[model samples]
Target: MGRNGVDRDRYQASQSCSDRFQGAFGAPRAEREQQFSKFMEHLPLAVSIKDKSGRFLFANEFMKDLLAADDPVGKTLGELLPPEEASMMAVNDHQALTQGLLLIQNRVNDTYGDERIFETYKFPLPMPEKRTLLGSISVDITERKRAEQALALKQQQLEELNRSLEQRVQQAVDELRQKDRLLIQQSRQAAMGEMINNIAHQWRQPLNNIGLIIQNLQLQYEAGEMDSEQMATEVGKAMDVIAYMSRTIDDFRNFFHQDKERQPFVVNQMVSRSLDFVLPGLKNSGIDVECREEPNVSADGYPREYMQALLNILNNARDVLLERKVKQPLIRIAIFRENKRSVVTIHDNAGGISDDVLPKIFDPYFTTKEQGKGTGIGLYMSKTIIEKNIEGSLTARNVDGGVEFRIVV
Candidate 1:
């Protein structure tokens, strides 16, 4: 055999004897080293060991793959990473080894233009050689960090959108409410105008009657032939006229004061009251008014306001028939209970509304009457009172010969 080959065999024999002696004393050192090497090689996380000088003593397969190095053992960190990063890692590693403290660091690494994040734990491994660190484990956390950042950004965007949407929705609701208030005010003004017109018509005949009676009384007194029975009868007639005027004023006051309070009332009574208020105008216009008695027809809603709406419809019918100068103007009101619903119908014998105007009749500020005479919100207010306040339905349709309004509560 050659001299070199003989020397190598001698060294192997001596190492085997030393291993057997260590095994005889306790767990074999060579066996323990072999098991530890195997465990480190198969570990999922990167593992490395460094001496107190910060030079690499050992590197496992995972560490070699992370560093992209074929032979990492005995290499210094300066050779594996940039100067700045290597210096920082060396300082941390030396401090951990000397103080016997754990060092944890999360850092971003950029090598070959590819960026990655790592979480590293440097722990002091219990070793016979005090200056040597036996374990340093690092985990790559690039994907997890990116996912968390993405989620935070999405949450922020969603919160911003929600705030914007809430603002827009609130603004729209405010605008609609404002429009509703304006419509109600316009309707109230129109109703007042109609009431004034009716009042003028009612007072004309009564005032004329009073004037005639006063003239007759004056003539009798001047002639010195005023009989006691005749005087009493004249006084009674004057008192009756005053009482009728008083009732008319009281009805108007009640209708205008509907906002004072609400009470559950019979729907039929409200309809009757509305008809009575407008009966004077209807009579002068030669229009006949009729209503069906329905004792059980009642509602829990605002009775006064609803009655005002009904009165407005009846007044409109009277105005239309008077304008047309119909030979036989007729207004019929009917009330009935059906399927837990109270239904009211109002029909008039005035000419039916034109097709072009019927669709927009309920719209605020839309009217067929002369501009100065119509405020044009009566039907609109009635719609609001029926749908929003009473949870009811109101609809108008042209009949074969006239117009009809139907309400259901």
Candidate 2:
């Protein structure tokens, strides 16, 4: 499909998500007012609401400012935006309303005539009187797109350089070593983005707590209840949250630091530690993850490199579940010893990959994800690390409902 074309799939929001904003029955009036306030003022993403008749019902400040509109409500797309942009949005809106939730990429030139790309999620929002309105959350992805394009160009240049070097130097060992260095460099670059996302997940709750603490202090002060005990208590709570965030940063920094030499590590312990880096994001996505480990299993290798491989596999599982919108998504990890070899298996219930794609899953630059979302080197580097660097075995198979990856060292 072309860049302008929509890549769509059926979507239903999860119950846990629905419960957050609306319980089994519905949100209370006061709670809904608070949500409205946050949605309109605090949200940084552009959001819009449109009725079936194509007249805008409402738009958040971000969306309004983007369009430079005095007021968007009661204005049709054709009346509010440039014809080409309006037409594109109108078509997308219609599809979202009729066909269920849609994730689409759109390029638009706002009133200022500056073009920007957006990654938008449009869904049908049920309303009072059994009415349905189109709701959208759009995030500007122009910078992210540019970064992906640059990374792709750099990868192409590296491939060309490698070809030239292979022709000039006939030493097989040296060429292989050079390729390994480049692979590690590329893997780190790709993994860094996900690590940052994990960092955000690690800090989200603490940040929210700190914000509430500040709000409480304000309320207490205004009500003349700000005693020394309360003052010390709130300040302490804020400090503790700050400390936790600091420790999270330290953990991430250590995870990414290159290992200088091989080291002995406990298998179960390493698996637990590896989960720490990614568990937060996985849970936030509502994926159920369970670890069943037989303790005391040991392995000898570069622990950091081994952890990187685990990160790649776990991330791929998460992406698959999210992309497929699988119900009750679950990832189960088991660690044990088989035939005196330390074994770790990770499996997920997202539908298994196709037969034709399974054999090439470990091949570099082979990805099933849409453009700019995947570099296709993660699994390749992962297999290389386990089999080559760690001298371990990594294999994959299609289980009954999903895929399983086993690692032995």
Candidate 3:
């Protein structure tokens, strides 16, 4: 061999081939050497030989391209790569030789940004002159590794989904158990925050009115102007206000119930009911809401959750209006039949969402509001309610002056 590279050992390893074909196969040393070069150069493999110090002694065309090297002889792997990459390659090289079948996997992006995975078979090759070299033969294996990973991930996801399904089935009352339970739980939690704020706003006026009524009763009794009829009249008025507050509680509580079966309900009436829950808070923020509905428009689904989704959208609208502080904040709601499907559109003039963020608004746990001010799941739950629970489509778009969400069921 030339330059103390392969020498006597390699020639002897081909002795049987020489014996069989003699002159035709290996009689001429130059012809045998040329054949070896041609085979290695054309082989569809990353074939390379490196000295003990990792200096490249020989590299085939495939190996040269793989290393991004036009010429690799005399240069070490360290010289061919950046310091950190060289270090990583060195560690991987050592690990590959120690592995079963000397299999080494490399994950990196190609020049075109496509991801590639390479599995290399690495080992040591002893040569003449008491020298040992590192040898490796790597095929593409990118597609193979990707397919194996995809299959394994698919299997893992199925197992995880099955476990999650079993757990949800045991604890949830809803027939749909694709973590409908989790969505319901988190939805209720998010709604509870808005409910409390609305309660504080709506209760303020009634409580203040009650306080004045009590003060008036004390004044009348002190002046000897209190009569049975007068006393009862004031008491009844107070009772009516207390009853209204109780009904509000009932409205909020009933929304949390899981529906057992598909039921028909007036779509407009449900929309008005949802408004009752959050209109107080919206009005307090000076955010006017206008709702228009066509007669006899109805839907067949979990109406309560549908209303909850409406509430979520309305609450989101209210928050946005309050945040942006538009001169004239308005939320418009319209319910009608479109393409024989019940359609509800809620729109608000809050200056609309940005292009970058509008697409991800319905994605779970995606919110632009400051921490503690917004639970990103608001719109996600709204989407889950319409698409999953109600078997419909929920979509949003930037309108002329605001964002409009359309729910079709």
Candidate 4:
């Protein structure tokens, strides 16, 4: 009887423990389901579960916020979205559920006098029954779309600005190159003129000597006293005059050919050559030239052409001074170095240029000389050569007694 009572007590205790375990675990599961429902109530994106028939099985807090209603479950999407959108959404959801596919769409939602764009994805549930469509996520893309559009507009504007700037820069470069070519051609022409003038002056003295020699030869021949040696000497003198003229032609040819190529040359030597070309005219016109020795001023490109430009300026000054009948027709040429720049100053005692004409001196076709005497391109060409070709500067200033042309490179 004692053994039977022990077995019965043990059986009753086991049953009681099993009942307590079932109750504890079951109540917690119910509580957990309630908590999960509360959590889904406050999601930010509209959350919904739908059946294959496009009826809502569940709608979360966000859905309620979107619809401004409660108990939206079991309702068709047509009750929420506009008729067109609702029909489209229902079709997309039905396709996703039936075909086990995913659908993504970008669509606009209108509310309160504004439009909001959303990107929505409808995906099928993995359940085999195909009765449930698992989930849909809609993201607000309105601000992002606006920003992208703004960025595209700005990019287009930037491209346009770059194109305009490139065109303008190219135009400027072309203009500069055109100016350079014109200046070079003008320099060649001016050098040719000076060379011709020098030849004319050189021939005068030689022609006079020849004339005197011929007169003597004729007198001796008529008297029947012409000597062979004397004749030879006279012939030799005449030949020397011809040879000198030939050499002058050669020099002029070389000067005019300066546009062929560029090479480094001594500045002083170039200056000397230029002076030789203009010296005869200067002497004949009685214009005194004073040039200072420039030991340190050397250039690296187109030595002959550069010297031609300088000589043209000096010759122009000389002509101006002589034309004005200045009592002391003086042209001062000086070259010095300052701040890594070559400075050439050509000043003349020609009472300075007139204020009325100063501003137009460097303009093409603007000259103070009478017709056929000046082409008016000399100063303009000079400025172009110095500034555009050599990357230098040329400026004219009126001093107390004369006009000074300052060139810096």
Best by lDDT: 2
Q: What's the lDDT for all of these models?
A: 0.76, 0.84, 0.80, 0.73
lDDT of 2 by residue, 112-193 (tens): 7888898999999885457677888899999999999999999999999999888777677777778877988899877888
Write down the worst ten-residue block by lDDT for model 2: 5-14
Candidate 1 lands at a TM-score of: 0.64
Per-residue lDDT of 27-73 in model 1, one digit per residue for the tens?
A: 56867556555666798778776655565656778788778788766
By lDDT, the candidates rank as: 2, 3, 1, 4
Each candidate: RMSD to true structure? 9.3, 40.3, 17.7, 11.7
lDDT of 3 by residue, 1-409 (tens): 3445443433433332333344566447766766766777798888776655666766789888777789877677788877887788777666544552477677755556687777778886644565555677778889887798999999999999999998787667455565667866888887988888888888899899889889999999999999999999999989998998888888878887878888999898899898888988888888898878898798899888888899899988888888887999999999899988899999998888899999999988888898989868878988888897778999999997999999998
Kindly list the per-residue Cα lDDT of model 4 for residues 248-296, writing each as its tens digit.
7787778766555556566667767777777778889888889896695
Please say which candidate is ahead in TM-score: 1 or 3: 1
**Which has the higher lDDT value, candidate number 2 or candidate number 3?**
2
Report lDDT (Cα) of residue 47, candidate 3. Answer: 79
List candidate 4 segments past 4 Å from native.
1-137, 172-191, 206-243, 258-263, 354-360
Off by over 4 Å in 1: 1-141, 204-244, 258-263, 354-357, 370-373
Error of 1 at 156 (Å): 2.9
Among these predictions, the greatest TM-score belongs to 1
lDDT of 1: 0.76
How many clashing pairs per prediction, in order?
0, 0, 0, 0
Cα error, candidate 2, residue 59 (Å) = 99
Tell me the spans in candidate 3 whose CA falls farther than 4 Å from its real position: 1-178
